[model samples]
Target chain A: MSRYHTSRSSSTTPVIILYDTPGHSPQPWAPNIWRIRFILNYKRLRYRTQWVEFQDIEATLRSIGAPPSSVRSDGRPVYTLPVIVDPTRNSSRPEIISGPSNIAEYMETFYPARPVFPEGSRAVQSLFVHYIQEVFAKPLLPIMVPLSAKGLPPRSQPPFSHSHAADALPPGPHRERAWQLVKEQFDFLSSILDKNVQDGDGVCVMGHSVSYADFALCSVLLWIENMAPHDGWARIREWNGGRWVRLREKCREYMDVY
Target chain B: MSRYHTSRSSSTTPVIILYDTPGHSPQPWAPNIWRIRFILNYKRLRYRTQWVEFQDIEATLRSIGAPPSSVRSDGRPVYTLPVIVDPTRNSSRPEIISGPSNIAEYMETFYPARPVFPEGSRAVQSLFVHYIQEVFAKPLLPIMVPLSAKGLPPRSQPPFSHSHAADALPPGPHRERAWQLVKEQFDFLSSILDKNVQDGDGVCVMGHSVSYADFALCSVLLWIENMAPHDGWARIREWNGGRWVRLREKCREYMDVY
Candidate 1:
């Protein structure tokens, strides 16, 4: 199968285009998109953001002839957000990589100087990212998605309802139950962060310098701050003995688009 | 409350006593205990092992006045295995550290030269261990426990059944269902390990040397290898391009008890 790449430009150094979800306002709420953005900024790679509306993700991906990074349990292709078109690296044609981990791997291979995996720590760091994406993010989904739905543009609301209606947290008391779950997950995370204070400089998630693992975590935190500040990040920023706050501060510079 | 330390002698450098669960044969199958054993050997710390049967766990712990590492969701204390009594490190009164993470922290604080939370990677390393213990190990419980029960001593079998009867994987098709869950978890792990080969030496889980993260993973691998070699470990040892076998070889030195 041919790989998908964006249309080329005049410059020798091809600019990479990042596709992100556009929320109620201008910023992106999805953690997966923020993950790629964090890596791009961290590696000092030049990139531009293309704000795709929620309802248009599948269509936009298919129109570009980009392959989905993964498939559903039943083997159906899952065309998700956070696909990137890195034109200069890999091939003469701009290379489009789908999914957060896939894009991170591509960036790491092409930009080895600005290392995210870090020496021999790749295996564990990958595991850390996997946990953040799969296990750590599970509880926050219920709380974050519904609150995020409130900020969605009217055009995007229908698809959000259609896709996530059953999975989204219900209003009223169930919200409290979901919050309880969120707290439980944070409590576990807090205990883990406490180890940093005891062992290291207590700043970044991995080593003194930032890595992909930190980006993976900070993305989740950013999602909370962006999508549901009152419902989630507000409480988390203060909890865990301000570990969350310090973590964001450590990675705060990378949040900026280059 | 006062901490419980194992009865000790007058040596200048005090020895630590590790509590582990003994299987039917002369081997340890519990991942949590294997975790501490790995740390003790990695640090080259002088320690002795005390094998406790499953039936005797509560009574033995209570007799020693050892505090349970954690409580259940309902708030009752959980008298689990893998507690360590470390002497001559922190206080004149030896410290009794319970649980894998707790003991690992004690070792790191005392033995900084042979580091587990390498450089400034404590937070990420801690999260990695947490995920292994909490998330990655969840699906294996059902598959491991019932199979492991067959290997437990005759005296230890009843209480193993009593305490874990409801949760143990049932006979026949339920066992198949458990194996299915186990395979799914391994598939996720194999993807993570594939990154190591792509990025680093593809042996250790974390940085160059075998750190605590490797121990955490190896502990699970060892549990499978010892508990149900044919049923569980055989399938995984070859999967993910032999990531598990290479991981075990990387940490093989630590598997030997002092």
Candidate 2:
């Protein structure tokens, strides 16, 4: 496994453990988890990855007393990965943070240098991230979720396959419509990026520097590249005048898998 | 009519004319037009209002040699209001700029002192505005369109009344569902604003300073208040812990009616 040492001067050992679920591929693939990974790498924080199987996610999170990320329809708690355990804050007791937003906030508070949210941009950046997930990514779920499930390891495949059975769109009009919706979202985002063309490459969402919004977007691109590199990534890379390809390249430095 | 003069030192007279449609109420009611009005007032640009009837919008625009904002499906050009004619750009030939985005950009380019897009924020701010219009204001359209049509002047009433006839949502479950969707959007926006609570009142979409995003949102709030004051604005003002009320108050300075 690849590891990154802390660049910051710290007397103690770097013990920030990021809990992630492994896919079939050697590299990490989940978009939500990739958000934190991007932030960790961007901040150049020293952290280690603890891979847990999808089946063991609940038990693993419960053992560490991390709160449930969400609740299922049946009123049961639904545990999710991308939880971080940071002993740097307190050596005796590591702070366990669940949920991507919470973890991001914790990291930003602890590691102030190279902030993910630039000056006075937390609210707007959060809105951008919300738009990416709720509007942009919502249309892609039916197409991507099933593809993503198929890319998981055999032990982790059963749960995702069963849960996302209804999410599969057969290769026909329905799937085409799904892809068309994804394209429209991409077009809208591309237009937003176009405004920044005068400044530079128009890769990062905010200004010239990389922010959480870029990480949030690039994480999805990474997911698409990881899961459906042949079809999905091929189409997306060419869309919006190759904006996504440039964005992925712009964010390539932070994609160090650990 | 209320008139605002330029605070800047200009030897020549202010000759910026904004084309807008007037409602039955003395105040301006159109949300799209309000966006420009907010910018003009915020920038403190000296401008005159040329009230255009809804039916006269096309003829008025055509008279000024302004291009059509869009084309109807039947191949006919569709003209819209909130077009600005600035003689300051050229003495012999005035520059007639249509569309809110274009007008805002023009204003920012010329009047760079008080920028609506604060430092490399043009792209993300535009995305915020897009989200407000395409997503947040969409469900409110079916509910607000018919109500807005009723509030227009008699000459302007016919076109809106007929055009939005099918957009009316009667008092029933469907209307309730529309409001619920609006509430959900408001909730999402409120959460974004909540991130700024520690900073201040959490009124502005950005930091403490008001920007174009605030104008876009406040324009919608003004629409609800103007069209459906009792039911729509009443409910919205109370929702999300009086967030909309605070935003409207925050932007009240820019709500000049001229």
Candidate 3:
């Protein structure tokens, strides 16, 4: 009940608890969790991250009674990270929403000003974000998991290793093949940005102003920066006329964690 | 030079020739071609369609020195339909642009008003259109080709049947499997639209108003309506809360041919 840290010296703004996955240390780098953080920062929501190790995510979510918004291919409810517990603005029960999109909709609904889904743009912006999650990020899993496992603490790395056991890559040639798949996806994304460049500033994914779509992209970029750095982000940052870097710059204001 | 039929009695307006493929009869049902037509109509440009049989597409394009905008997967130049010849607004040579996106960009550049991209929306809209073309439309190839062949004239049907010989479905079981694949894609699209509906008017693909993305979706919808209405559109039209029908209605004004 005392999850709310009401500091006597500071204003009585309710602090939202963002259940985030820890990277090498306790810092957050998980793409999905970063999506929520980006929105929180963009909307100036007061939130503190409660870091959860990879193996403890399900238990933590269960203890808090937060339900997942998605499921595994086998129909098991996927209890993943990026669950948020937000106390009502007025006096209402605290709300727990699991997925990034769900949390985003909650934010946009509750906090009407500083909107993310501007009028008429949500449909296409959602499609763009879905494509990034379902298609573009898929090919990066093989590369990302191994790199992330290396970056995470020794205690947290085992789960990633075991989880990727079946999807383990063959020694040399398979890594090349995996990177090729990532390159193909990157090339496709570049082409999409190239087309939009003629219409606007060529930096943001949505209209002239940045929206949730840009934040989604920035989350992926931040994941690569933290997990693989040179091996991953360096290889493709200059691609498609330096699109990844420009997109990162566009979302620079929201990338910070206070 | 006299391709311009300027009637002395009527208003002097140059007509653009849209080279389209003839479906079963003379109806134009190709999704890519429909994209260009949507933009032309959206811009209120005066245009006349010159229907060309599939067999004569290469020769017809070559005769007019029109270059294909895309290449086949085998690295061969792809001479596809949906080419447009727009006579200059002034005394410049007529420009022939092939491919839907190219023609759209050309229209926006020359026409310079009644915008489809809408400020800041082009990047995400372009990504949505690309996904429709590259990913969403891929699984439907087998089902669409067979049904479209049924609608084609006797002369055009043979080539389609021969080309799809390797990918031919079996009598009962394979057709069922193909429909399942189609259903899976439809389910994915429905989910995307459902998310967008929570954000805006549950109809158009982009912001509040219809844009090029909606046109892209309508193109595929029109293809299904003409090629396999009962089997294809009937099954998924009502999915995700009648999103397909609502989207179709959103772009109804652009669907008509003058």
- Quote the RMSD, in angstroms, for model 2: 3.4
Query: What DockQ class does candidate 2 belong to?
Result: medium
lDDT of 3 by residue, A45-157 (tens): 77777878777889889998999768889898879878998874643678889989888888988886899887767667778888999899999988887777777667776
| DockQ of prediction 2 | 0.60
TM-score each candidate: 0.86, 0.90, 0.89
iRMS for model 2? 1.8
Please provide, for model 1 over A1-258, each residue's C-alpha lDDT reduced to its tens digit, 9 standing for 90 to 100: 011223334456668889987777656668888888888878888777787888898999999878887889999998997899877665567788898878888888888778887777777777777777777789877677777776778888775666664266655799888878888877877776667775456666664777888888888888888877776777887776888888888888787753
* Off by more than 4 A, model 2: A1-14, A163-180, A199-201, B1-14, B163-180, B198-201
- Find the 10 residues in a row with the least total lDDT in model 2 chain A: A1-10
lDDT of 2 by residue, B1-258 (tens): 233443333546756888998888877888889999999889887777888877788888998888788788999987887799998768688888888998998898888778888777888888889889988898898888888888878777766655745367877899889899999989988888887665445788878889999999999998899889987998898898898888888888887755
Candidate 3: which docking quality band? Answer: medium
Provide the clashing-pair count of each candidate structure: 1, 0, 7
- Which of 1 and 3 is the better model by lDDT? 3
Best by lDDT: 2
Q: What's the lDDT for residue B13 in model 3?
A: 62
Residues B92-174, model 3: lDDT tens digits:
68888888888888898788689988777767777888888888888888888777767766666667666653354655988
What are the per-model DockQ values?
A: 0.60, 0.60, 0.64
Candidate 1: lDDT of A249?
85
The lDDT per prediction is: 0.76, 0.84, 0.78
